[model samples]
Target: MKKISQKNDKMTTVSLTQILENGIWQMEAEFSNSQYYAAIGIVRDTYNIPADTHPGLDPHCHHMVSYGMSGYQWGDGAVNYKGNRTEGNIAYKDNQIIKAEYDSEKGTVIFSVDGVQQPVYVRGINEKVRFIIYMCYSQASCTIRSLKKLIAPTTKHVANEIAVQW
Candidate 1:
């Protein structure tokens, strides 16, 4: 588990070193002092993190998809992102678990709060991506609890036996 805390007022974004490309992956994080702004999501591996800006809201960048604890989802860039407060009304409180799952096969990213899945999701992601977390206000922190790849389930067919009467 890794904990990321911000000491300044500027929004700070942090991303994992591992890049996920063609598989199903899941990440779970816990936020503290998230009353103001704290977000968890994914950013393209090629995205360059700005000095001080939200990953999803960075005007100069358009390769991010973020879900905030304040009940909002952001995709691409601030200019053409898809989401708002009303669409993602599942606000999370401090210490609540936030889960993000990405399926490269389906080209979708989904979010869940405290085990309950949210209706809002981001799609059309076919490139390599990395998990990211951001915090704005001072002393705001997020702890990455787990990051793992889920195995895809396989399908099987069974044979049925029948009895014939002569």
Candidate 2:
């Protein structure tokens, strides 16, 4: 696999497969935009990682996130997809999925994003997905340690027990 160290908060790097998949969806599928992202699905049904179980990895761990299972169309588009702009080859921005709900009576799915659940109707579905989990450090040292442990077979995917943000 490839790697890009010396990362930053906003400097989000996506997987190679993700980039390629996004390209295909943008061209073939009637998606809102040329890209999509699915990150919040990291925990699946859980709300957040519990504080007690969070522990430090072995001396050799390396990497922040463990592997995950996800199916596309992931990610909120980097732009605002207003309406059926994808029709007639028009363009709508890819948006994020803050929340998803099923409407019983209306027989429609609603997207709760940024704070509102808006209804959307898409023509097709793109199901290229992957899974991701966390192996993290709140600081650079923790990240470094985690990366080191990843090289060792005996080590496992674990986060720093403490959540310190400074």
The lDDT leader among the candidates is 1
List, residue by residue over 98-138, the lDDT tens digit for candidate 1: 88888888777767778776666666787898988878778
lDDT against the true structure, per candidate, is: 0.67, 0.21
Candidate with the greatest TM-score versus the true structure: 1
Question: What lDDT is reached at residue 52 by model 2?
Answer: 22
Give the residue spans of candidate 2 off by over 4 A.
1-36, 39-97, 122-166
* lDDT (tens digit, per residue) of candidate 2 on 1-166: 2222322222122222221112111101111221222121111111223432111122111111111112212112211122111111112233322332212222222223434322332212223322122212222111111111112122122332211110
> What count of clashes does model 1 give?
0
| CA shift of 74, model 2, Å | 8.4
> Which ranges of candidate 1 are over 4 A from the true structure?
58-61, 71-86, 153-166
Error of 2 at 148 (Å): 41
- Scored against the true structure, residue 10 in model 2 reaches a CA lDDT of 28
